[model samples]
Target: MKVLAARRRDAEDIRFLIDHLGLTNAEQVLALCGKVFPEEEMPGRARLVLGDIFDDS
Candidate 1:
């Protein structure tokens, strides 16, 4: 349950990056995630979310 909620949050965060922040690609997502979550694994998770968005498109 926690994992599912986290995934949902990641998707929302990625949407914000793409829609509001104008981030449209993996490199942009990774770069922003690196800055926001420097010591965490969020960059990878963000990439997965971004990938899912790409797959959907």
Candidate 2:
């Protein structure tokens, strides 16, 4: 998947996150995806099913 989040954070040579501002969790991200791909709500659900990622995950 290629999520072009509004913000991103990385370390020395490692990527941390590619996330949207104010949408920090699974539910919020899912909702945003729903808007971007309304016809494929099923695929959006898959993203929700994938769960969340954190700074220390």
Candidate 3:
């Protein structure tokens, strides 16, 4: 439904930001995630996922 579609769009937007914006740390991910999915509490989760997806180390 509409909610699912919006989620898909948000996922795509997140991927685009990850690929293009050079996010270098979990803090950056937390900031962007807060803006992107403000309804959710996601800082810890965001840090975990960001480690999996983006590791400059």
Q: Pick the candidate with the highest TM-score.
A: 1
Candidate 3 displacement at residue 5 in angstroms: 15
lDDT of 3: 0.54
Task: Estimate, for each residue in 1-57, the C-alpha lDDT of model 2 and write its tens digit.
Answer: 233232223221122322325445655655666687776534543442334343333
- In order, candidate lDDTs are 0.58, 0.41, 0.54
RMSD of every candidate to native, in Å, equals 4.6, 7.0, 6.1
Q: Give one digit per residue, the lDDT tens place, for model 1 in 1-57.
A: 111233755665556646776766767756765677677565345456667776665
Error of 1 at 9 (Å): 6.3
Ranking by lDDT: 1, 3, 2
38, model 2: CA deviation in Å? Answer: 0.3
Q: What's the TM-score of every candidate structure?
A: 0.58, 0.43, 0.47
Per-residue lDDT tens digits for candidate 3, residues 1-57, read: 111133433544555566677867657767766787788766344445455555534
lDDT (Cα) of model 2:
0.41
Worst 10 residues of 1 by lDDT: 1-10
